[model samples]
Target: MPGQLQIAVLPSTNPRLGIVFALYPSTELSSPEVASMGMTLPSVPRTHELPPVPPDAPFIARERLLSLDVFRGLTVAGMLLVNNPGTWSHIFPPLEHAEWNGWTPTDLIFPFFLFIAGITTHLSLSSRRARGDSERAIRDQIIRRGALIFLFGFLVNGFPYFAWANVAGIPDPTFLQRVLDRLMHWRIMGVLQRIGIAYMVAALLTRKTTLRQQVVILASLLFGYWIVMTALPVPGEGTIGALLLDRAPRTMEAWVDRVVLDWTRFGMGNHIWVGGVTWDPEGILSTIPAIATAMLGNLAGRWIGQRRPLTERLSGLFAGGALAMMIGLMWNWVFPINKSLWTSSYVVFTAGLACISLATIMWIVDFQKVRGWTRPAVIYGVNPIVAFVGSGVMARCIYSIIKVPYDGKRVAIQSAIYQAGYASWLSPRLASLAFALSFVLLWYVILSLLHKRGIILKV
Candidate 1:
């Protein structure tokens, strides 16, 4: 707060006297107050002589970085595009996740989101602390926000609240049975759920710690995960974790998911990922590295928030990102850059890329003053939760919840529409890509309207 305040002096109308102006941040000084005092706010391009205001004015808010929002928007848009293909089987190579032990462009979307969340979490906490918010209040807020996001993700996983018995060629069941089925099969881990967990853990870890302390904790997490994942032998697998890296069922992360989430033994097991049933991409053990990923972003946020020149900050990002990438590549020989596992090497590599990507955006949008092409991404970025949750619900409705008459019997509305509108006119891969793009464009329009109305769906 002290660093943000600036003071200036100018000659008054009398010319013999000089008036001192204390430029409280625009957040602390309202426009009307600035006008009444005959001063220009920081955001305004004009200058004026003004009476000095008290330096201890209460903190109100801080300016957000446009580059951050644009980055987040692009990530959210990419998530929508990747998640809503016309047909999952027809996706391009870059759009689909790697089958195992490697990554693609699609894999980066989730980690980028987590990284952005870490940066925003830092900014938000700093603003609150500046406002004299108590530690108790901040912790409660973190817990509450993280819980709500997790619950929302859970609901999204079981959206429409109905069983697809009829769609799956089974006889329709009673409403009670449908409800029970949904609860039984509801996924326990997902993108937003992992995000909520990572956000909460990373925030609390960084809350009362110094930079050196945080870096130590971060290194411990990465190394601890590596030690357990590679050095330790997985229980019952009769082999070391390194030997089981290629087998999803045998990996320590997947084994934990099966044990803790298995409803048969633990009463929560039925909630495992529907994709694999036995393992999940966002499973429990893997979340450790995910937390490290968020912490990495938090560290980057601290660096960005320093009172340093823009060029210096940009240079640091480039150099640090390069260093991290090199480290990740070296470690990948042992751990492998596996997104599903959220491996340590994967965390370092992806976070490095995140840093460099963000720095590039900052240079283009923040330093270079280029503004015209940023509008669409900004709209999606500002209302990320809206785009994510809304698109998710809409996707579920079309893909599974609704049915339409097809060539012989009924089919999911999504399939019906895709076959008739897109696949009918283009190659399978092209149709899939086109459908995904349409989904992105549709959300852009929706988010654009929300932006115009000054609506941002925050969690």
Candidate 2:
């Protein structure tokens, strides 16, 4: 393959010369001319040159902006912070999701991740198309990546599969009871699970769909969800939840959640979701509406990539985002902005926020040329999947699987740190947050090394 393709390059002294030697683009030298006693042969493009995009960023194409990577890196950072509390016993209200009917900063995390994923899908597919990749190849690639992500989520959620903590078939509880307790405690739906489903369906649906078609589909999903939720009677509560839900279409998505993705545990305030373990926040039914959030992101990415002025692109995102946010608020009177079920109003509202956030990033990084804080984020962004998976697995193994007996107690290394430094001296919340931040820094350092070495692990 290297021999067949023409590789583009430039002469530069880069630190990662070893990788460049192996993976550099292949370029054919022009027919060689005889050298004279005092003359040297013409210099061919150097094999060590990078793509034309700045060395500081990674995008679908080298010349494209790096806002998407920034978005993704920030998101991964947020996920690590939220997931890795020093102690579960002490958490700030902001770090926790709202009690089913309100919004919080933490609620924005999932939507932000999904929204970025959508934008990335658009940029990547478009770049591939520009390079004349066949539609079939793109489809297959999407399917494979989507499946792998979903499986990864499932594996993470099912870590240890059987509880090693329950070794020796302890008789304090029946063996069956032990396993059942684990299942009961297991959180079935989570961040990556949602990403998997959303990417698979959204990518297939949007892969070949026209912009007009996408708008139509998006509008129809929002409104159609509205109608079903308000009109249809919930199974257990009848129309109480539907009517009390206050939002027309938002209830539709929740109703779907209650009907299909039941199997939830007791939620906040001891209030059960009322469908007998059905209606998870990250359940199957609400995911339908989640796709629209990704669509909103795709639309922004498409607009940004157009050859329009940078100001025009940013303004368009702000304008569209404002409109969506207003519409969401207007609809919220009938359908509350609930994150657990991902109501249509919530979807619109969050997507608007996502759009505004992304536009601001583009305005500063790409437009104003401010790049002071971009290097760390850009490093995290280069190999997003690797960073996320590696960080998650490493954190889990250290915190849970590895145990050290200290002070006559069997404690994980993470717990030992908290016990000694946090519970003993500092406030739990601060300690927990510190641990989370430390986790992020650890991953960031690893990613920095990868970035410096030009090790982009794209799968």
Candidate 3:
């Protein structure tokens, strides 16, 4: 019984219900503790290492991968942890985004999510094809789903749809005018927007292409982006893009963001990132390499879908990932591994790390058959959009939208909570970490309930 896998059937929105398996020490599948651990599959670490099956034994024709779910859950959990610290002013170095170039642990999270998106795209499309779905149906689904995701991101950007609570120069203005002002200044691109765009383009591009053809397309994207970024001149700046890289606002990407997204000439004001009015981290030109990152994951998914032994697949992933890391590092010397730019080197490097991380998780959960501790991640992974959108909206309300009287002055609810509950007794850094951990735990409770009810939100 020690090495035997335990199976649990859960309802799913997909026609194929999700079948999950875990290796437990006993056969008490219905125990309260076991029931608490829920995961959905549609669907991590250091050694750079890494299932087929019988019918009714977890791997049916539309079997789900527990490891993929676990990996995605972990990434989403990490996003929540990093994004919701008690105070951004006091945080650990690794948890923080690199100021400009290079990467910290935080930098890897977005690319990891995108890479996983690419893998699932491949797996999902394959499953649909196996079910006798026509290519036209598949294409329509891709476009519709991709558009919906982008719409969700767009909506989140302009959430609450309310006027600013405070404006420096404006006296009390009409509510309609204030609302219009907010609309005019709403941001146009962000993490989810970029993810939707990259996933849609990468999926469509690889939908009908052969393995060799996908590789060629990937190569063109990375190399072509590198050439454009390093060789092309910034129109009015009269300088190559590479030369302007250090000056964030002067880069070609920033120029494009300003030109297309900023509507000041038409009185709509800027729609780029509020942090950088002239630029956006998830800018247009940089997305070319982001697509490459997703395609790399598509290639890995193809490899996993092969009929080879598990060991063979593991070896392929490890070897290929290591080779990619080396190549990306070599490329980094020229382009720099920049998260903001989503540079060519950053794409390859992060995708390689994603491969290695997923391979490691597979080895643990699948090859070794040890997954008892994977439930929290599984919960977060299954309903990522809910976590992302819900958390984003909640943060806005608590951090800025709602306020309370504090020290005879108004302060955001989150700030009041931090000052009272966390900052009162703990060091600044400790308090920040505690608040973030608490936020993660709170979401875990919410997601676990949904997971228990077999409710998964899929776009």
Candidate 4:
């Protein structure tokens, strides 16, 4: 197949000669090969020495940005910390999600990951296109990956389907009935499911469009969502006022989720929020703006990929982030920055924060060449899919699947451990924090070993 190709020269004992040639296909060069070549492959683009190409070069060869991986590692670490507290009931304020409108530090993790997914989508797709991958091949990959991610999430949600020992005098049902119940009540939407949808949409939108067109599409999504959410009258509310009409069960977003997902089918109703409202925070309507979040990340990826000075790129990122924040805050006056709604304002605000955070990390880690403290984060970053899926399954096992005898009654193994190990002496909040920290450390150790062995589970 015809495509753009790059050959990298490796150092040899003889200064004048190259020992090996590293071939990078447009899609992705495996980490082991990159490590062997002694190059730190960041998600950002870097200059390369290549043979002269004709005017119609099908691909662009670029260096990876180290900062992107560091940023991803930091985000995943934050996810583990917030998600695995000793007791969800006793979590620190920062670790807990905001009730409805405002956002906490905890809220940032999911959006940040989605944003990163968008950035990587652009990088990976561009590489494949340059490798002469057919349009059909690329589309199939995007759809298949998205589907697998969603399916993984669904399986995780229904993990360890039923406990053999019954509780509360409830009669034991047949095994087939148990399976049926799990399938019927399983959550249709969740963190990974939303990510899958957002990533797929963002990839398709940016696949062919120019930067100018992407910007226009992004603006339209945000503005269009704001109008639909605020101007349209909610079913029960009977009238539309942005403030009065935009709360949990009364909002249009929730109504759509209920109608499409059906409250009766799931029996549990909407499970995304704290209240018993029949609405998911990551519902169908809100996913529209979430796509904008990824699109914004795609824009950042493109900017970073440009052949420009690092200083110039950093400046552009910071300046763009500040501008986005200002616009987001301005929009928030009318459409409050509600994470539940995934409001247009919230998308702009969170994306702005992501850009600024990434730029700072780039400045310190990439430009300043700080290497000592980055190893842990880099380890976590390279194997993010592993960390996320593994940690999630482990948490579910601790929280629900395993039960232990406690004070003459069966209790969740996690609770028993918390009560006996940490909560016995420490205060509630402190105990919770300690447990969360321990979870993060455990995952770090696992990820570190994987990194040392040059194993990365790419999804």
Candidate 5:
């Protein structure tokens, strides 16, 4: 890693600049160290306009739009794939969550999505600024995008608004109580909701403030989260981090979620959760630092859009990412990087990975011009929502209402499919992965049609 750090690093110019490309020595950068930095090498181009490639980026999808789309698509794909496994009974290590602390590939999905969001936001806003779009317009766009995303999340959660039946076939709760419970049990703060809020806040912050100011905001939010999680005494002193884990009263996020979230939906408090605070993973206060995740991404986006050489931009991103990650890791020794908490360390770790990943994509798509292998991913990348929605609809239909006919009993379609194809040929892990990919392809066909027809269902 030390040797890699010396592999022709470059400094980034100030915030408001343009893009460039430069050649440099190859280097190998990986993990805890990787977490600390903007990103590690493996180059990709930012624009379609660039020099011919001699040493292309390996495994990275080239094509600026495609890179972003794929990163986004991958995130969406990952969410669906992870959320929809053939059998939770036997999941691959990468698909599982960390026990108490530590991370796996699954943990990277959310932050990676957020990272791409930040990158896309920065790139889009910068271009608009260049095209004479007023600051007011850009701000308006951000707000609009944010609001729409928020609305969509709410709508999605609100769908199929009925729970499993009670005794005598009666519904467990009344509509009013259910609605109230949405806030009470509504599982307040979720994947899309977080994305919406984070995007809006981060966009405004980035657009309105200076880069230095943005950096300050990022640090403050992360530090603030750490302070609150640790310094605040548990209300009545049961357990420290526990209060922040579930629907506990002392936790600031739970209180806010109770007020702001759909009570009927997210309010159960985990079955045995006993945290003093009961923090919803996507609860209100937690979103503050989530904005920092996007900010780092925007900075990277701004840097990628800069006029410096491609190598230079990649170098700077890696350096800055490295520094942030290092700072986060050191902080983790004290605060710990808890994704559920969205702690400062988590931010640092995720943000560093984001930069490094983006740099790799830039190297491949933009620099190397080798996009052949990325076609399948690119297909999935084009329409993320289609993939998400299709998976959602299909899963519910097959796994629930549309049962498969089996030995005199109704069987889940998913189970039947797995038994017929996946089980028959591949190993469980391979079978599960294959199902996930096929699921992606099923949606890809629809998205490809939409893309061909220019019918994007934008938020």
Candidate 6:
């Protein structure tokens, strides 16, 4: 699940400063793996081709790509930076999400991770096939992993639900009612949830298909989504008016979210939180295009894993990325390139950017063999699930779970720390940036230690 970090404010004793600092985790760290919670295991070899092994044999490891790790690490670091601002309200323009349309550096993070997942999926599956695993065995592994990833997202979404009563300072509450409330309004789809869904679908689609077939599927998904979103008449709206799509609740995406994940069926209405009404950016309809995003990654993975020369691989990636960006921009004339919608244009544009970004990293890290500066990103990249999940949980605990008394009132520990430790010395935006940077640095230290200890937490 994309970790949703909510920021709350505390009343301060100082009369001059009305809102001293915002506290808590900011927003979703939606990724496949949660941090530090997975069991320690030996590092998997980068590449391997063992003799035919029994079906019951432990899954053979594939060659781990340093560029992929570094790319993933860079994405995770960006996730942390954008998510853990000192004060959510006072963030730099680049870090904040666009109001409704357009894109930001922050918007690229999720898709980049998804792209990496696609690449890794191809590499991993191919490695298993090389080791003589049957199609059934590989398919089972995909299903199991996908289900577990979805389950993890669900758990994170509902984390500490029971403890809400305590956090809210409710002395006593009807236990059953609390449980019912939590269950009734739980968010069904999120960052990790989307990843799991896209991963499963893309993996299955690419599992048996050739590159040409995969490309066809990708095109079909994007075009189909565009047509549905733009042409189909929304239930209540008179005609298929583009203007009607202005409000999120009026769009087809929100309608599907209502029908599929509607809380009213459970006697609640405000269960999900895209626009906090009826829409979710990571809702079902948007996931169609998201799957295309993953497929694009799969194509890239296939290209990278081919027996071609390094220059050829990089050239193909760069050319593909440029072409995708051009096509996306052309489509943006009609589609407007919105991230929340995960519009066809958005998918291609973001995926294009991801490709170029990854290619640049690969060129430097792999082609040039200049790897010294990649250590930080590699560390975060190697343990993304841990970094994302751990940071998210920690932020939630600091913001919501743990409380500290300040000026005769209990305040969130995050706010208190931010105000005293950061806001005291820095401006609000700088302080927020500092806090976020500190969070990233802290995780680097933790992940670096894990890397040193050979503790990889792969799902």
TM-score of each: 0.86, 0.78, 0.88, 0.85, 0.75, 0.84
lDDT for residue 65 in candidate 5, whole number 0-100: 36
Cα shift from native, residue 284, model 5 (Å):
2.4
Q: Which tens-of-lDDT digit does each residue in 127-148 have in candidate 3?
A: 5565456898777767766676
Name the runs in model 3 displaced over 4 angstroms: 1-63
Candidate 4, residue 313: lDDT: 87
The lDDT values for all models are 0.74, 0.64, 0.76, 0.72, 0.59, 0.71
- lDDT (tens digit, per residue) of candidate 6 on 86-110: 8888999999988888888998988
Position 157, candidate 6: lDDT:
80
Q: Model 1 over residues 1-459: C-alpha lDDT tens digits?
A: 321222222223332112111111111233222222222112222243333432332121222346765787788888999999999999999999999888899999998988877776665566556546689977876776677677778888888776766423347678777777777778878888888889889989999999999999999999999988888889898888989888888898888898888787755327888878888989999999999988998888777766577778889989988999899999999899999999999999999999999999888876786857877776676556677789999998899878999989899999998999999999999999998999899888887666544343334
Cα lDDT tens digits, model 2, 303-344, are 766666778778999999899889888878887788876789
Candidate 4, 103-191: lDDT as tens digits: 89998998898877776666666655554678887776677667766776767766766434442234867776666555555677777
Clashes of each: 4, 13, 3, 8, 56, 22
lDDT of 5 by residue, 85-202 (tens): 7776767888876654667778888888777778766655554453356887667667766766666566555444443223223356676555543333334346677888888888
* Candidate 6 accuracy as lDDT: 0.71
Candidate 5 local Cα displacement, residue 437, angstroms: 2.5
Q: For model 1, name the residue pairs that clash.
A: 261-269, 262-269, 263-269, 263-270
Ten residues in a row with the worst lDDT in model 6?
Answer: 19-28
Instruction: List CA RMSD, all candidates.
Output: 8.8, 9.2, 8.0, 6.4, 11.4, 10.4
- Top candidate on TM-score is 3
Q: After superposition, how far is residue 176 of candidate 1 from its true place, in Å?
A: 0.7
Candidate 2 lDDT at 244 equals: 52
lDDT (0-100) at residue 48 of candidate 6? 23
